[model samples]
Target chain A: MSILTALARLLIFPGILFAVPAAWFFLWVERKSVAMMQGRIGPPFMQPFFDFIKLLGKSTPQRTGVAGALMRAWPLIAVSTAAGAVGLLPVLPSSGGFQGDLILLLALLEVPSICIIAAGFTSRSIFGEIGSAREAVLSVSYNVVFLLAIISVAASQHTFRLEALAQAPATSLRWIGILAVLICLPAKLHLNPFSLPNAEQEIYSGPMVEFAGPELAMWELSHGLEWVAATGLVATLIAPQMAFWGLSALAFVALSFGIVLLLSALAAATARLAIDTTVRFYWQCTIIFAVLAVSSALLMRLRS
Target chain B: MNLWKRLMCYCRRRSPWLFHLNSGSCNGCDIEIVAALAPRYDAEQLGVRLEGSPRHADILCVTGPVTRNAVCAIKTVYGQVCGPKAVVAIGSCPATTNVFIDSRTLDGPLGKHIPVDVFVPGCPPRPDAIIEGVAKAAQILAERGDEVPEVITAAEVQA
Candidate 1:
């Protein structure tokens, strides 16, 4: 393929244009589902889109020097990196990804969390600092399981390419690895039970306490992109590949929406756990899932 | 560009995230404000969300009589919210200092501190009433000009 086609693939399909809108849709699904579960009427379908627009239209406060520049840059970095991760998703099986792209996707996916941490500290607010500290700790704790889960799945499939992973047959080991990944999603997305980093009641939006107007809008957009990228990864692995690109893309979106509903139920049903409790819970799951993943991969290798 | 501007105005009306501030209320108006956002009332259907931080809020809902102690805090919070914002004074206390009109500790009638766009009457207004007030404030926000309205208190009006 020429560089133009590659650019089209990266900048159009499964990229910023597609991912940003899908992110808004998924966010709406999450909110609407949670509201239904709680017996309340949620906002309209266009609520998230409207919110983004309203925020962009509002006037922002002035800031000076390095802190201001970094604050402005962090959300852009987050948005670009997350969109890149989503772009790397094997939504269409024949999209043509290179070898070891799974690792590149993982690295890209991790950039948002890093950006959030840096953004919090850069804001120089006490709540932002506290949020940054909590995010730092939680990122470390959950990534142990997150990394191991993806690695074990890769080991079972015997390939590090995302397209190959999507095309590979699902084994019991792969399912277990996927289960481990699901456990990490709540913490990563800042949903209930693992939402300590941005506990709005206690810390006042934590890292985002100081952000307003277009800057905050960028952060919100980046968050929505993260929803797309993370869930899209899980969806790609579990969704069955089809002979046609169109069918594969449809299945990919449908499965991702299903995961969003499942996650919304979990978020609505649970309460925020204490930071210590959340850390302990993730470590325990890591140990159990680690054993299952490692043992299952070893079994697969031994059988082969 | 005109269409874009109009669309923005439409969006501003549609989504109004609120930050609730209690200058010194008796908790009656506070409960009513909560009730407005509760399941039965569901202000969220109108895209009215209760935000935690002032910076993220488009509407500031001030409850209760402005007490002497809360005066500074209220000003600080009002300053934090981004522009193109609206203020809704909930309950009669914020509008006229209510029954505590003679209370020495109070420095209220919220309009004295910040410009208020909407006032919901009643000592402790009903949930429906509070929601209506918020919706009205959101409308004001959508059409509001870039300039924050100059606050003219009763004393100033009399003068």
Candidate 2:
């Protein structure tokens, strides 16, 4: 494929357009699953889409000048970064970007959280500040364990390219590493047990407390993208590799949806972890899992 | 303009986030509102969420008669909701000041201060009635083209 097609693919297919709809679908999946978990019929499947429309159509709210600028920038920044990262994964394994590709992917994923932190601080709402501080501390708590988990994925392969992982058979140790990464997924997505930053019952929207109208639409639209990114990352790392894999986008999508369901069930079943407890749990338990996965990866390597 | 109008109507009808205000209720109606969101009612299943901030809400579900101090807060919160919004007065007190009518501190019958689009009227309306009022408000909100809120009569609500 030429540069133009690749650019087109990145800009159109699986870009904002594809990613946006998929994101919306994933959000519907989330709410529906949570509703089912709580024994309710849940919103119409179009709830997420309707929410985006309603927010966009409403009048915009006010914020200070600099804060306003940043708030406006945040959703665009968040959604685009996540969508761009999705492009790199190339739904087709044949059209893939190579090893150490994951490093770029990892960096891209971090941008959204950083933008959220910036949004919380820049918006100047009290809850926004509290949320920003929470996100900052939470990121600190999870970054090392998350990084180690990523490194373990790399350790299982000879090359550092993300594409290699799709083709690399999943080993028991690698699965252990993936499971270790899965433990961090809830925190990464701010689902239950780690949903501290925006604990609705406790803080009433945290960083997003002050945002309204189109600004909030963008905030939520980016959230859909983030959900896709989270599940996509997990799917990429763990999807089974067979001769004709990645050809069936449907299967991979189903894989992601299953992961979303798992995460949502986990989120709905648990309460938000307190800040200190979140930090401690990440430090103690997840860290141990990461160390265990990494050591086992090394042990397997030495044996080979 | 036409497409925008349709999108507004359809989307507003599909999702209506609410903000609750307890004017001066005995907490009976307040608890019922909470009950509407509990497992049996689970208003969220129908796309009605209880929002923390007024700015995020499409419906203001206010319970109780208006109190002297709460009257100002109620209006302020109503103004804060992004438009094409609706207000559902959750109890008889908010509808007609209920038993608090003779109380000196009362300033309720919520419509006097803020136009109430719907009223769920029992001293403490059932959770189902509260759900109906909110749902009714969502429909009214979707159809509003700057329509002024007129109080729904007791007869109309019962019908």
Candidate 3:
């Protein structure tokens, strides 16, 4: 690919253009689905966009520059990295993806979380620090499961390239790896039971409590992007082969919505777990599921 | 309104995230606010979310008669809310000090300490009324924009 073509593909297609809208759609689905399950009529279709606009127009609290500038830029960094990950991932069988992009994606996924931690510490607020600490702990706990799940997929498919992963055969061992990915995802997404880091009741929204206006807008937008990227990652990992690109994309949307439904259902079904219990659950339940998945793949490989 | 103001009006009025504060209320008005937010009343349809932090909030929903002890915190909290914001005084107490007027320890009638843009008058206002109050506050915020004045400070109240 020529430089301009590659730049155009990266910048226009999967970069901000594709990632932003897809992220917003995921957020809309999340809100609408959660409200439906709760028997409420939810916000209008453009609510998230409206929120972003309002935040853009709203005034931010005064803080001195350079340090404040960098502190406030975390959300920007986060959303960009997430969108960049989406740009790297293949959405269809024939979609072009950069070589050895899997490792880059894995690194990109961690950037948002790291941003959260960094944003928390930079604020100099005790609650932000506490929230950051909890987030750090959660990250340590879930990283094992998340990495293992990814490794399972990589090992099962025999290549770390996303294009190959999408076209990879859907064997029984791969299904187990998919389950491993599914079970470990809630922590990454900051959904309920594992959503303690931002618990309003406990810590006043933790790190982002002090974020107002455009800062908070970016935070919300980043989470939205993370949802799209994470769900797309899962969809590409498990999607069945289709003859048409549109059919596969629809399948991806349906699969992501299914994931959202499961997410909200989990939110409704469980209370927030305490810090220790959350760690224990990841290490015990989530990790065990991941370990089982990897062992099954290994066991199958040995038999062959 | 021009295109820019119109857009801001739509966005600000449509998505009014609220931060609820109780200035020594009997918990009645607070409960009503919760009722308004719950699934049945579902103020969420209008995008009226109850946010945890004042920083992220566009509307401040103040309940009960402002008490002597709650004054400073109220001032601080109200100040913490970023601009293009409005305050909805829920229940009769914050409006006129209601039945608590004769109490020596009382410091309210909420307007003495801060600006109130809307008032929903009931001992404990209904969820519908509370929702309307918030919506009214949202409208006030949308139209007023950057021209909205600072909330009355504690020093000014003493003067």
Candidate 1: the clashing residue pairs are: none
Which residue ranges in model 2 land beyond 4 Å of their true spot? A95-100, A242-246, A295-304, B146-156
* lDDT at residue A211 of model 1 (Cα atoms): 91
Model 3, span A1-304: residue lDDT tens: 4566456545755557777877777788778887887888898998999998999898888889775897778989997888888776666444343442678888998899999998888887788888899999999999898888788777776778777778878877677777877776788888888987788878888888788998899999999888877877888777787889778868877887687778767876678889999999889888887787777766666777
The local lDDT score (0 to 100) that residue B103 gets in candidate 3 is: 90
Query: Model 2 over residues B1-159: C-alpha lDDT tens digits?
Result: 698889888888878899998887899999998899888988886689889878889899898888999989998988888777788888788888987788889886787898778888897889988888888888888888545556543222541
True contacts kept of each: 0.94, 0.81, 0.97
True contacts kept of 3: 0.97
Give candidate 3 misplaced runs (Cα > 4 Å). A1-5, A93-97, A296-304, B150-159
Q: Which stretches of candidate 1 lie over 4 Å from their true place?
A: A95-100, B151-159
Q: Candidates 1 and 2: which is better by TM-score? A: 1
| lDDT by residue for model 2 (A132-206), tens | 899999999898888888787788676567767776887776777778778888887888889888877777788
**Model 1 Cα lDDT, one tens digit per residue, B1-159:** 488888988999899999999988899989998888889999899999899899999999899899999999999999999998888888888989989998999998888788888888887888988888877778778887456767642211100
Supply the DockQ value of model 3: 0.82
List, residue by residue over B1-159, the lDDT tens digit for candidate 3: 789889999899999999999999999999999998898899999988888889999988898788899999899999999998888888889888998897998988998888878878887888998887777778788878887666642111100
